[model samples]
Target: MTPPFHSRISGLAARTLQRLRSAVSGRLIDPRNYQPPLPLPGGLSRAQIHDALTAVSIDGSASGELFGYASSDLDRFLYTLAMVPEGAVGKALEIGANPYFNTLLLRQFRPELELTLVNYFGPGSAQGKQTVSFPGFKGVADAVTFQYDNVNIESAALPYPDDSFDYVVFCEVLEHMTHDPLRSMLELKRVLKQGGTMILTTPNAARLENISAFLEGRNMYDPFSAYGPYGRHNREYTRHELHMLMTHCGFEVEASFTGNVHPDIPLGQADASTLNRLIGQVRHREHDLGQYLFTRWANARVASEKLPNWLYRSYPAERMAEGQ
Candidate 1:
């Protein structure tokens, strides 16, 4: 028999069945089923997409599903996992989980992980040990506390020995360490195990403003340095500068990404500049770089991966470290 003639229509029908199975764990569904959210942007700019989400936050303030997560925290969470490495995750840490999404990611992605959260201050039901001025945490989930050695990343003696965690998350946080970011990173590395991962998201100095500066032959680095913006972030990173920082600290830099869910008026989309100005007046690094091309590739199939969502999530890249 000639394999029963798998025609185009039949093949498509079979593939559709396969997809539905894969998406719904191989369950048959009626055509009237509620569709999951798609990542398609309807060709929106970065800010427009976030604005839409924010609008929902406004109208549905008491809503539980997406409302529980802060816009920034969810953005960070999406960015962090969207680019995770392939294979088993050994261990992970997020020095800053904010009040919303960061810890959610810790719980969601790697709940089995031994979790330790260090922030400038502690929030939520998470416990902490006052090692440094900053608050620390020990959140619940399948995750347990390795230790709440709450030393400031910028402080001397990071309160833990070297090569500690399998992964460390530094989201929109490093540049704020004006006192000694390098020392903080060194401490982060100290805790990160050899061949560990760092999922980093920060303001990109190489944004449209700096691109214009480059076209105008002006100094771009100083304009976006880690020195002073709202007197909060001591510096920001151009991709290369960040890579150097990680490499210098003995990190392989498993992945580096930019997610500006909090961005200035995205290019050509609804200006939102009024909202943009207000955000700028308060938030320091909101407009650095809203979207980025990925640098690394992860191993397993992402559960809920979508294009805009992936763009908004963490990406792995150039994990091949120099010495290691």
Candidate 2:
């Protein structure tokens, strides 16, 4: 039998070889080749965001509560903002504010724009608790308005006046509100000005990783984690599902794209432009593989009458019966 030390060394060698093979076979995407879209002014500079995202811990040496993931968040935020016109957004509200990442970036990038950040977690309250937790507020407390209320996207009415915002940013929060996405969509529409643009980002359920997971008969999510069903991704959306949901919710989809492939995946040794070309071939529908479904939707006066029942429930019951 092999000695324990020899076995350990063999294992390490196998892992190293596997990683090298994966890199060569296109399983591992080089972070350096990731060419994100140009920033639309008032957002993190391209270099700043890219550097932040690519700064991985060598040998897992980095330390912090959210050490590795913070860059991913920044990436999503920048990508979502790319769809918005620079200096076009005036008054804006961002749903599901975690600290002030979105607002802080906006305030710095677009000083002229007024921003209100709201969260369901009260001050001092973490993600799910009803206490009070304001982790990122101390730094930018004076820069913007921060409110803590139990804002349930499924049912609770938004504590905002009608048409309160020129645009809205809903990033990475949709999949969590699994029970009543329609209600949240309507609530978002209510606060948004007519013709206002809504920038939304959510995970792609059909991502290749997820597909592989499903085929392998493994639980994709950690059941023990997250705050209730709302905290975890109860329902992820495919590109088609997202388009239909937005179109049904009285919004016109203006543009769509996929972004932020899993940081660990090596997107081949191709240049950034070449990788982007491959992405374009899928018409951004492969957002699942990329893991983010980035979309821009405009609020409309008359959404399609054939909206789903979940959306119509808040309206007249008769409208539901009439299929209007």
Candidate 3:
């Protein structure tokens, strides 16, 4: 047997090695996810954190949440706004507006607009005793319109006039709650006025690495903790699954790509082009090694992040952010 001090040193070394393996995980892909956050008066409360974190942990750290994930996807969507034209959207409805989603950003992008957001509430914020509470009015007063309401049931219709809005948003909320999310998707189709914009952001279920991991039998959702596999989640979805559902619901995909992620890692003293390339490379390859990566990840995950974004199409994986 090893001496106590020697064993301690060995354990520490093993942990470090495992961390290196996990940290280097970005190399598994050349590319790319955030969750729907609840609106809290104090802002993103502990209970909200616990539930969202629990949902991600259901599949360990890998199966859910990817590097530069959410922010990148949203940014891509934002860049395309010029093509779709904001005038096409008059009033909007955002489903699952608990905390995260850049409603503030939308306010910035389309200042002359009206928006409504919706979501499930727990017992504290809910009308039903067993349901998730409803956040206090002050919680979302700053971010949401004056017309927010808690309609708790999973399959219940929204509290709004028919054809009341010109746009609908189902950002980062599909896989968390609905068992038959297609129904909700259709409901969104119903609520959207003619020629309205329907913006959605969800994880691509069939990612390259994920498909590889599945075949190799190493999914990240392997929950070894007290809770079962995929802690609070009902399912995970791929891009193809999402596309089929969206089309089936009667909305056409105007444009789509990974949104709201800053694929670059932060390296010091680089030119703007180099900085952009390095951001993706750094984010993709070395994210788990630095606090900055977590910052970028949080920004990527949250609806309104402060991460600096670049045009990803110009620097395809071939030019920079190479897989190793």
Candidate 4:
């Protein structure tokens, strides 16, 4: 039945407002056509990487699914590899090295370096071994069985000596630190050689897609996962915040930039351009809008004994003092 005139007018006004919002925000980019901005590293082709990843077999269904997801995000993995310095040598540690996708690539590219892998499963520490088999580039099947230490980085001290590793790959693990991120960073600092390099990568909390999601009134947080809290991203950082954290952790930033590693599925040209222009007007857009922040830092000194007040609160008064 037809409503009253005022009711009909109100409906029309609501529809108009919806359309206006759509026009202002623009449409998202088609997911199928989105391509990665960076190319594969070490002259490796996508097909080779795909074949290698597909050959990987883990024990559990959840692990298999995780590996599959890592396989799909080839660009992200390659971009991470590219950020690692070619000159990096000596002992290298990879934190949270499950599925071992990047570990395989590291072995293929940097065979000279000794590698140690770490993963967290429970509250305490233990040692275990993992064996991964994949078809080599020469069409021959190859297997890698490596020993990995199981320790909760947030709580337990790493099972290593001081200045143990020359390089540490802490990619995509920071956001999963549910309790104490500073503790993990401090532990990493303790193990890394004083002048060694550490490559780290994490999702940018201020990426363009997040901005668009916020504008559209969509929830921006990660959903609960079947794999538990560590399976989901608990905290993300902006480029600036990461730099600040790294500096506070006694690392000197050697190189840092943000880039789109994932497909531009939900971000379109119109919205990106509009936001970019708006962001540019106030300050240089820079690499602030990229999907992920990639950085290489040198271990310079001991990590801060106190947590930065900006990042934490409700702590002991002395522990919450301002950071340098």
TM-score head-to-head 3 vs 4, winner: 4
> CA shift at 238, candidate 1, in angstroms?
0.7
2 versus 4: better lDDT goes to = 4
> Order of candidates by lDDT, top first?
4, 2, 1, 3
Error of 2 at 74 (Å): 2.8
Candidate 1 C-alpha lDDT tens digits along 1-324: 111111211244554554345345522221111111122222434354333332232122333444434445445444554444433356666776533244443454455666666655422433453211111122221222333444456654655566677767667677566644655665666677665666676766655444434444655443343424422655666766666555555545344334444333223322233323433354323323333322331211111111122112242434222232
Any residue pairs clashing in model 4, and if so which? none
Strongest candidate by TM-score: 4
Cα error, candidate 3, residue 181 (Å): 1.2
lDDT of 3 by residue, 1-324 (tens): 111210122244544454444345533222321111112322444444333322321112341442233333444333322222444447877665543334444554555667776656543543321121222222432322333556633477766666787766665566565344554655565566666666666544444334344444665342353433223445555554555445444455554443223343322332333322433454333222110100000001111111111212343444332221
Clashes of 3: 48
Listed in order, each prediction's TM-score against the native is 0.50, 0.66, 0.49, 0.83
Worst 10 residues of 1 by lDDT: 1-10
Strongest candidate by lDDT:
4
Model 1 stretches with alpha carbons more than 4 Å out: 1-69, 122-149, 209-231, 257-263, 266-324
- Overall lDDT per candidate, in order of appearance: 0.44, 0.58, 0.41, 0.73
lDDT of 4 at 13: 54
